[model samples]
Target: MAYVGTFSPNHSLLFSGTKHSLQYPASTRRGVVVVVRAESMTTEKLGIKIEKNPPEEKLTQLGVRKWPKWGCPPSNFPWTYEAKETCYLLEGKVKVTPSGSDESVEIGAGDLVVFPKGMSCTWDVSVGVDKHYNFE
Candidate 1:
């Protein structure tokens, strides 16, 4: 069976067939692992989570089409999220760099992105943006 999960610095979790293994340092308490059988997996960059080209069914489940749309031309600005935000990009490209972080997360058309609550970041919109966004 296929599994989808993410890795942290202290633990390594791997799955094959029906068996799974967790390898962690001795000092830390055991952590929980959540796995999903998905056609696509999510990835993290610059503390932001992104699911590239997520399955169509997943979009439907999120009711992405019903979310409010926001757009902007090429510009750079700092933003802080008071609540968790999830957005589906319908067009354009953006690079978001978290506060004090040099690395940036690049997101574009067809990407599902999640920004954690209280996150402070800079948004550099390079190709304009047309997206449906929801705050949770």
Candidate 2:
């Protein structure tokens, strides 16, 4: 005797090096990160797997990158992404410019910022900078 269910093939385990343990929702009996493939409940039939195929837009799992700048730095122009990002300042200060906004964010050590996904922004780290980030 056995039973079957549905699951998402892809899901964020952890944003960065941050470890995580999965908990079954009240409605769920028990589960794993991935589950057995079933035919009866196709994506449409089960209202799951909404995206047949999504673009591959993967970045570093857990990464730390240092950015330096010259006096009166112009800006740190990077590509906009669809994943929410949090930055931890290790040194220096930076001005984070989010898309659709005129004001920018200035953050320093022990300071964290949650950047909304799909934000177009620039980084202006005064006195150079070092930072650690977690993105899914």
Candidate 3:
């Protein structure tokens, strides 16, 4: 059996089948909060990831500590990330489909998402979007 475990505040493991890999960590030592990306075998190619149901406090703290809050009315548009973007959704829903791929991921309220740089994706806003975003 495979398992994923957190070793410290700064480290985590990625396990698939019988193999294990060490994932990159964002240090929690400097009195700062950071969100680290988790890579799994199946979802690795999308270049966009949504964290697995972050705690309410974590989501609230991210909004309070982030910049440039945005709201978009219900609509659809194609957007390309010029730089790495990490966003926490406070309300609304959206489906992002990468260009040339049939797979899509739905993002909604209380979700923390990371979109990598140069990723070409179309945004399908289903219930509008309200979120706090920051580019890395």
Candidate 4:
């Protein structure tokens, strides 16, 4: 049977990666994107998925004065992964709680910082804030 719209069975298998996935405000959300394949997954037992890259021109066009949030779920937390990220706090504020750390820092507008993969942090998002994000 062909599954549709945000439904994934236990035995379901999806072999693909996101060239780019954009998260919206989520009121009119629809459909299941895809599932991870059994093979080619770096952290199989850990349930990690391999993601594809997005276009450069599109990324470069990312606008400012928006709210963007990055979250690392307890289930998908990377043990030791590293990626250079560009964080431009356009509005409101965000707090990142890194891995193995009990404290977090609040970042507001014009506060630019970088967080590596292994860093575990509970992203505390403000009531209404969205940002244009491009993570490599």
Q: Evaluated with lDDT, which candidate comes out highest?
A: 1
Is 1 or 2 the stronger prediction by lDDT? Answer: 1
For residues 1-136, write the lDDT of model 2, one tens digit per residue: 1133334333323423433344656345335433332222112211111112112121123233432212333346654757876555455666766656667656654344456677677767665665566565
Q: Report the C-alpha lDDT of model 4 over 28-75, residue by residue, as the tens digit.
A: 334545443232111111112211122333234554334366442222
Predict model 4's lDDT versus the native: 0.40
Q: Residue 76's C-alpha lDDT in candidate 4? A: 23
Instruction: Please give the range of 10 consecutive residues that has the lowest summed lDDT in model 4.
Output: 39-48
* Candidate 3 global lDDT: 0.71
Query: Which of 1 and 4 is ahead in TM-score?
Result: 1
lDDT of 3 by residue, 51-111 (tens): 7457656656766345789999999899999999988778899989999999999888867
Candidate 2, residue 88: the lDDT equals 51
Ranking by TM-score: 1, 3, 2, 4
What range of 10 consecutive residues in model 1 has the weakest lDDT sum? 1-10
Q: How many clashing residue pairs appear in each of the predictions shown?
A: 0, 0, 0, 8
Pairwise TM-score winner, candidates 1 and 3: 1
Quantify all predictions' global Cα lDDT against the true fold. 0.84, 0.45, 0.71, 0.40
- Model number with the top TM-score: 1
Native RMSD of candidate 2 (Å): 15.8
lDDT of 2 at 18: 39
